[model samples]
Target: MIEVRRFKKRFGSKEVHRGVSFHVEQGECLGLIGGSGSGKSVLLRSLIGLEKADSGSIVIEGQDITQMTERELIGIRKKVAYAFQGGALFDSMTVFDNLAYPLREHTDLKESDIKKKIRDLLFEFGLADSENLFPGSLSGGMQKRVGLARAIILNPDTILYDEPTAGLDPFNTRKISEMILRLKAKKKTGILVTHDMPVAFEVCDRIALLVHGNLDIIAKPKEIQQDALHPISIFAHGDIT
Candidate 1:
């Protein structure tokens, strides 16, 4: 469902990715783990055209997004949803409005239909009562749930999660894991950028390690764990977070 080939990116004199490459099949979640400044989130953003690569290609379902213009990316963004690390909700808008904003802008669904969809999503994410609350008033976990709920409301074929369980407690983390599993059950494709190893191993079918500006290893979770000599397994137990 997704392929990134010979991807390279630079900011000023610093280059973050050099010939980085990977692929994700449909209905699979690939966990991205890396040391600080390895550009995991940058890779996620590049998929939806949030960060344009300097060279190479990012093809989603057959279309190369790296060659597309900003206007052309508007359509691409709908099929690929990004759940930002901090929820990225509007400070002033209520949760309902925050989730409704995308539907209203990109979809032709009526107000009644939008409300129904939002209500169902909130309920499924255990946030039925949060529809009327603002982002500031909710707990860290609830905000993440709302963000995930909003990201999936469009029923996008792919989801890019940037640290979805970064700051949550165990219960909340498990909740997020369960939610991700639910999405997997529905055959949703995803790329999860997370340093939370337990969650990564629990929810991801495969985990890849980003080192020295490239993906040095990609393997099943058990394979990663068994190879203690590998960079990924060595770094897995480190304080990368």
Candidate 2:
């Protein structure tokens, strides 16, 4: 569903992604594992058109997002949502409003239908009782779940998850993992950039190890464990530190 070919991105003199190429099939979740500053999240941003590639192409469903104007990218953004690492909720708005903002901005759904949609999402993500709560009042896990609820509030075709499980306790991490699996079961495609190995193993169909501006290995989660590449081996065995 998504293809990135020779994606090269640089910030000033720092080149992050150099000739990086990978693809994520429909109904598959690709786990992106890499060290800090490896530009894993840069790929996620590039997919949704938030980040631009200097000298490559990011083709999603046949259209190259790099060439899309802001107006054209609006349509792509609606189909592909980016779930930020820190939840990125609006502190000024209540959870209900935060989730409602997108529906109101992007669609013409009636107030009644929007209310029902928000209610269902909150309940599905286990935040029914906290709809009136603001991001500040929610726990870290609760905030992340609420953020995710807002993300899929549009039923996007694909999700770009940037460090979804970062900083969570084990219990919350499992909850997030289960949530991703539920989405996968529904046939939603995704690119998950995470350092949490267990979460990656649980939800991804294939894991790609990125290092030195390119993907060093791309294989099934179990196959990644047996890969002989140096970076893949250390990352798989948790010896990167």
Candidate 3:
């Protein structure tokens, strides 16, 4: 459902994604793993159109989104959603309002319909009673769940996660990973960029290893384990592969 061809992104003199290329099928959970400064996050942002690539083509569904105008990108963006590392919830807004904001801005749904949608999402993400609470009042895990709810509010065809479980304890990490799987089961094409090896293996249908600004290898977890070229082996076993 997502195809990136020869994607190249740079920040001034530094190149982050050097001729990166990959494709994600519909309803597949693709894990992107890499060490710090490996350009994984930069590629994720570029994939989602948050950071325009210096040179490349990003096509989702069927449209080439890399060079689309902002007006054209709006409708395309509605078909994709991104969950940032920190949840990125508005501290000034309550959970209900936080969920409602996107619906209000993007759709013509009335307030009563938006209320019902928000309530349903709150319950779905296990935040039923916390609708009145602000994000600051929630735990780290709870905040992430809220972020997931918001990301799926529009029922996008693709979801991009940037370190979905970055700052949580182990229990919360598992919870987030399970949520990622569940979201994929619900038929949303998932692109999970995580540093956690166990979580990536547990949730991803396929894994892509990003190293030194290029896509080093892309395979299933078992295939990755068997392939000598897998960059994750170097990451997990210190060049022992």
**How do these models rank on TM-score, best leading?**
1, 2, 3
Q: Please, what are the lDDT tens digits per residue for candidate 2 over residues 1-241? A: 9999999999999988889998899989999999888999988888988888898898888999999998999999998988999899999999999999999999999999999999988888888899898899999998888888889899998988999999999988888888899999989998999998888988999889888888857888777666666566677676763
* Best prediction by TM-score: 1
Q: What lDDT tens digits, residue by residue, belong to model 1 across residues 86-169?
A: 899898999999999999998899999999999988988999998999999999999998998889888899999999999899
RMSD of 2: 1.5
Clashes of each: 0, 0, 0
Give the Å error, residue 197, model 1: 0.5
lDDT of 3 by residue, 53-156 (tens): 88989999888889887788888778889898888999999999989988998999999999999998787777899999999999988899899889889989
Candidate 1, residue 118: Cα displacement in angstroms equals 1.0
Better of 1 and 3 by lDDT: 1
Off by over 4 Å in 2: 226-231, 238-241
The whole-model lDDT of each prediction reads: 0.91, 0.89, 0.86
TM-score to true structure, per model = 0.96, 0.96, 0.93
lDDT of 3: 0.86
Model 1's TM-score against the true structure: 0.96
